[model samples]
Target: MASVARQARSAPAPALLSIGQVLAKLSPEFPDLTPSKLRFLEERKLVAPARTASGYRKFSSADMERLRFVLTMQRDHYLPLKVIRGYLEEMDAGRTPELPGGAVAAASMLSAERKLTRDELIREAGASPMLLGDAISSSLIVASDVFGEDSLAVLKSLVELQRSGIEPRHLRGFRAAAERELGLIESALMPVARRKDASSRARAAEMAREIAGQLEIVRSSLIRSALSRLDS
Candidate 1:
């Protein structure tokens, strides 16, 4: 143990990473993270990376951890930047504050995102290969050898719906509905998209997120209203 400690002490520290390197390390899990988004997060004071003598940003390991936490909170819980910033501030002040809405904690954020093989996804989601195949056939899921978290989530939901006698074939209309919504978003974005400038591109992405959030609110309200009628 002492020899191990001595070796550890002799080891070199990790190098500070550039923005591109940070993105390369993180983008697989947070595919939507772009340079502009990182800058936006920095502007919001979610993270404070170091600036080089030449004005380039350099991120330490702690910065990476904070970024992962912020991104995970946004992706999984859909928490807004203000809420997340408040929660983080509490933590920074040496208070172990609970996350609002029971969001996942910091420790879990450090783990790498899972990418499962077809068989692994089936096993993990408790879904049958045939069900997955049917889902692909129905355009509910793309055919892929390796599946990401979104695919796993969909498969898990399908498994529960399957138990209730709902099949992938029955949800085929969902794909079409999604395409229509995409069309609407694209049409709304045409003015910004036509600008062909970096800032406009970033604004377009932010606008797309805002529009999608509003649409989700409308969709969820409709579903809840329909369910209330069914219950009545």
Candidate 2:
């Protein structure tokens, strides 16, 4: 054990990372993490990376972990920046603060979603470029250089549907239906949005998710009921 400890102590420390390096390392999990976004987070003081002799940003391993925590909280819980900062401040003061989303484990602090490039997405989803083109043109999917996990899932389902001879063209009405549902959600949120507080905005976002979930349930039930009539 002492020999192992000695070897561990002799190990090299993690290298400090540059901003571009940080983005490249993290963008797979946080596809939206551009340099501008990182700068914005730094401006908000959510993270405090060190500076090199020439003033370049240098991020230590601890800084990377802190950033992962902050981004996970923002992405998963939709916590306001002030709230996240306050939690971090509590931790810095040596107090164990509760996580905003009732998180029970440290793993919850590292909720990075999957990200894929356009070609990678197609390969992973078993989809053809023509299908992707049709999906985009029909508004079934938005064209992007990088896609989130949801986009991959959608494309995979489309691939299965394609095998069954159901094409993206057949799903064109989905976009209009989704837009109408979004309109409803927007109308519902306007009152809360007008309040202009961070708390209000957070609440509105949560409520909007809940309402969208309910709308999805209703839509699913309607489709199932219509299918039941055909079976009858």
Candidate 3:
């Protein structure tokens, strides 16, 4: 079997992938990918496609697959680009990078996992119906038939907050604050999000989520640091 890189080099080069063609191939899996976002990924050195004699970019099947892997890791694992790049570099060096156990299996599991019914979510978080209602009313958890990992994380926080009498209503401002932060991210990604390609749009969304997750981590760390000062 031809190596993925070799196959990419041997594939017939298109005249150029009109931003449209790129989206058609990549969008089903990555619905939010856009042309500018693709360029942004290039700028970050996550992907390097071949340039035409006239400077037009021409991606290969291999490039597409590589991109799929990279985007999937960022979206599902919350991995930063630097860490993802390191993993790719290991693969490029002819070593099979050891993914976390059942990583591939886990990818398939996400949709089902995200389909947690209301009762299931309450059970998982050990939360009561009243608490769940408060969470939804406060916008800390969006009302949905099925809940994703994001909802679960919020539920976990609510469980902790319950102990301190910080009910869901008390954290309603958190939802508003998150929206404000998201607005900043959307503004930064405006140029990229304007493109019509699905892959680029998907990649942009994944990038936004990754950045938001990082911000949440930083915010948590700062709060913990401040609390330690009080303890001292």
- Choose the strongest candidate by lDDT: 1
Collision pairs in model 1: none
Which is superior by lDDT, 2 or 3?
2
The lDDT-based order of candidates, best leading, equals 1, 2, 3
Question: What RMSD, rounded to one decimal, does every model reach?
Answer: 4.9, 9.2, 7.0
Tell me each candidate's TM-score: 0.73, 0.55, 0.59
For candidate 2, write residues 153-178 as lDDT tens digits: 78999999999999999999999988
Candidate 2 structure, TM-score to reference: 0.55
lDDT for every model? 0.85, 0.81, 0.76
TM-score head-to-head 1 vs 2, winner: 1
Instruction: Write down the lDDT that model 1 would get.
Output: 0.85
Please identify which of the two predictions, 1 or 3, would achieve the higher lDDT against the true structure. 1
lDDT tens digits by residue: candidate 3, 1-232: 5699899998875554545677788787676576876786787788898886888787777787777766676655666776677777888899987652246434643552356899989999989989999999998888988997668768978998899889888887888898889898898788879986766676667667667767878898999999999999
Q: Tens digits of per-residue lDDT for model 1 on 80-134?
A: 6777889989999999888744623434454656788999999999999999999
